[model samples]
Target chain A: MFFHIILERNLQLHPRYFGPHLRDKLVSKLIHDVEGTCSGRHGFVVAVTAVENIGKGLIRDGTGYVTFPVKYQCVVFRPFKGEILESVVTMVNKMGFFAEAGPVQIFVSNHLIPDDMAFQAGDVPCYETSDGSVRIQKDSEVRLKIVGTRVDATEIFCIGTIKDDFLGLTGDPGGAA
Target chain B: MASTGGEEEDASELKLGEDFLKAKCLMNAEVALILEKKFETLQQLSEDASSQFSQVFEKSLQYVKRFSRYQNPEAVKQVREVLSRNQLAEFEVCVIGNLCPETVEEAKALVPSIAKKDRMDDEQIEQMLADLATIKKYE
Candidate 1:
């Protein structure tokens, strides 16, 4: 899920950058520092929309650095347990297939897949249903339900399942619309 | 009688949970729009677009473009307006907008909270779905 939320971060600026371009420097620095970073608490910061505030700078006596508290609005993508997400399959294996929904990586174990879809080992590994009606392989689009999640400092790992109703291969792999 | 509705289910079972329970949601179309604007700004600032974008931003831009059901900004705004006018929560609004479920049954299955809350009856859901489809068709 994508959320537009306000987040606060303290940015440290060197004394050299304390001139007329200070605000621009801080905003750009905030973008560079925050975008694409993942926090266990806030998920992945996709983009910084706006800088809401820059608090009073606190100077450090030793380093000659100024720390400013910055509040910004950003778009973050966070997957929650039970959320349904459309993901593109990145790889397939006997253990399960690894799929990516934007920045989040999800592992849908073989057990989480429907029982009828048998794993096919080949140059291009894939899971196919009997009668070959459905195939889930690399680049396949699937709608799966997130069953569990583990968040690390720089990444979010999720376990998803397509065993339930309205969950499964959404489109053929590598198909052009 | 036993509770068959979502009341018996754990809050985390199909819920957004505490952190996101009240956070404003963005539809894939809106994200695509925002990212495109950011990209335009970045392109004006630097010759190398690759250097300015983080991997997450790049991936998200691609994903949103590919999955966004409504590409036209007008359509996107209208979709949100239609959903919000029906009193749908921000999260629910985006979920429905992103998924573009063809039927109410599918919508309810993908977002169980709508069903549990009884926010809309079957007829209203059908109407909302029709409204969304019309927007997509025109867009």
Candidate 2:
């Protein structure tokens, strides 16, 4: 004879896209996989459960028993990805433009600029490099992705690559209408 | 039962008073009684009735002062900010829907003029009023 215990309670979780049966199976698998996983520099699993579905990939915590939408396949737990720094263009030089995003002055290489866009001077109300190779306009929005980090005797620098999408211009991502 | 009937009468009087007020007619003791009853109803609807009532009352007062007096400067500045903030569009529509002015002409005439001090163009003011009309249709 086999006996199973089903508990019901409100849970604070994102709406799940999968049904209870599938979600239960997935959660069980995840627990089994991470049962003996080691935690160190990489990160480790925390907790796993199923949640109610609220459409648009949203799950909410409801009164007990994990409720998930009958669409999602699985759920996984992981540590935060990384940190994002915000900066604004201060000046544009031939090498790059200076932007201050959260007390850090970083340079955005001219090569990282989008294609077919020329650095026009005077017409635009922003600083332009002498050689016109690099230009940063005033009030231009920029997001830097952390690629590497460095620590010196008294100073700390974060090297980032500005090649990803949604890293330039507010509302410029996907060309908002 | 007596108290409830009295309360209903008081509420009816209050609704009548509000109608008169919206029509820009002078307030009378009887109309005041009716408005008072309407306010009582509002109070019953929410715990924060006083604050809500005050806000709506203030907005209505501001509209009357500017619309009746043709003082356009401060009102114009406010309208401009509303336009720039994209809030005016929503607000005007809501007002028109809520008030549901009898006729388009009445609604157009009710549009609050910008203050002369503000010096906004007539075209811009007209456009804002037109937007209000659009809201009235839905309401």
Q: Top DockQ: which candidate number?
A: 1
* C-alpha positional error of residue A174 in candidate 1 after TM-score superposition, expressed in Å: 3.0
DockQ values of all predictions: 0.40, 0.01
Please give, as one word, the docking class of candidate 2: incorrect
lDDT of 1 by residue, A92-142 (tens): 999999999999999999999999999999999999988998999999999
On lDDT, the leading prediction is 1
Chain B only: TM-score of model 1: 0.86
Error of 2 at B21 (Å): 64
TM-score for candidate 1, please give it.
Answer: 0.94
TM-score of each: 0.94, 0.24
lDDT tens string, model 2, A1-177? 000111122223333424666555544444344322322211112211233333332333463334323321111111111223344556655455665432234555656555433455465544334565444476565544443333333222444445554444441212221
What is the DockQ score of candidate 1, to 2 decimals? 0.40
Question: Which candidate gets the maximum TM-score versus the true structure?
Answer: 1
CA-based DockQ, model 2 = 0.01
